[model samples]
Target: MKIEVITLNAADTLQAQEFGADRVELVSAMNEGGLTPSYGTLKNVLQSVTIPVQVMVRPHSFGFVYDEKDWNTIKEDISIIQELGGNRIVFGAVTKDGEIDEQLLEKVIHHAPNIDISFHRAFDQVKSQTNAYKVLTKYKDNVKRILTSGGKDRADQAMDELRSLVQLSHELDGPSILVGSGVSPDNLATLHEHIGASEYHIGSGVRVNKDFNQLLDKSKINQARDILK
Candidate 1:
């Protein structure tokens, strides 16, 4: 399994890399659930850490539903990331009725043919994960990962659904289930035993006092790394 840490700046990426993070998701405006980091920050972070950095491509925190202007902005950000030698991104879009926006997803994949996109937590808003999983697997080549909370507020609290999703992925050679939210070192073993996912995304879990605004706690990160191993 891989441990993906959420990082706010170049300094955080360095800390994450030194502390056994297999990967890091770079973003800004974390208080609003993450938005795109500035170009300078992205460039500095990519240079600061050797671990794979997955940049968040979200244009806004208002919702997953997007318009033409939003689409253009997302495409623009992707171009910049690719130019900076970044070939990994985290993004997702949904329809008004909460279905995966296949149109937008397709456009992004085409826009960044060389990039591997991890469909972000916007997937949690879908009406049915089973149906959404089916939609995602269609573009499994580009949508290489799904960062979800098992369609709930917390992945640990949605074991039954997560287990089923994990099984479904195995059956279809589907994207890796990058489980996120409510994941802490205290409960990682239990979540792994129950859900058996291959990747874990952590935010506010390995931070000092479990606070997102606080610096990442080295002890907590090492503890989680040990457990994953």
Candidate 2:
């Protein structure tokens, strides 16, 4: 098991790596659940961090129902990220009626099926996680992981759901679940012992007092990393 921390800038990325993160998910406006960072930010972060950086390809936070313009921007961003030497990325989408947007999912992932990619937390908003999981399995090779909170507001509160998802992940060569949302060093041990997931995505959990505005807590990050190991 390894820790993947959410970072907003090159400084944050450096801190994450120094504090024991194996990988970093680079984004902007984390309060809006992370938007695509500027090209300059991406370039600087790539040059600053030696660890694997997973660039987020989201254009905006206007829900998962995107227009054609949004789709174009998303595609362009993915290509640019790859061109800029970013090998890993995170992205996700959903229909207005609360189902997996198969059209968009396939459209984006089909082009770069071999790249390391993660389907982000939009999975929580889908009507049926079981059905959603089935949809994601179609691109199992491209969609390497699903970052989710077990269809709940918080992952720790939905252990049963996460456990079932993890079990399903082990079958059918589906993408494994990367548990997130309120996962902290204080409770990661319990989550791991119960859910048995191999990866955990931490954001505010590493921040002081679990506040995003505060600096990431070095002690908390190191503790979480040791526990995951």
Global lDDT of each candidate: 0.92, 0.89
Candidate with best TM-score: 1
Error of 2 at 143 (Å): 0.3
Q: Where is the poorest 10-residue window by lDDT in model 2?
A: 108-117
What tens-digit string does per-residue lDDT give for candidate 2 at 154-208? 9999999999999999987799899999999999999999999989999999999
Residue ranges of candidate 1 with Cα displaced over 4 Å: none
Candidate 1 C-alpha error for residue 84, in Å = 1.3
Provide the lDDT at 41 for model 2: 91
lDDT of 1 by residue, 69-164 (tens): 999999999999988878899999999998999999989988887788899999999999999999999999899999999988999879889999
- For candidate 2, report its TM-score: 0.95
Name the lDDT value of residue 27 in candidate 1: 95
TM-score of each: 0.98, 0.95
**Highest lDDT scorer:** 1
- The residue pairs in collision within model 1 are none
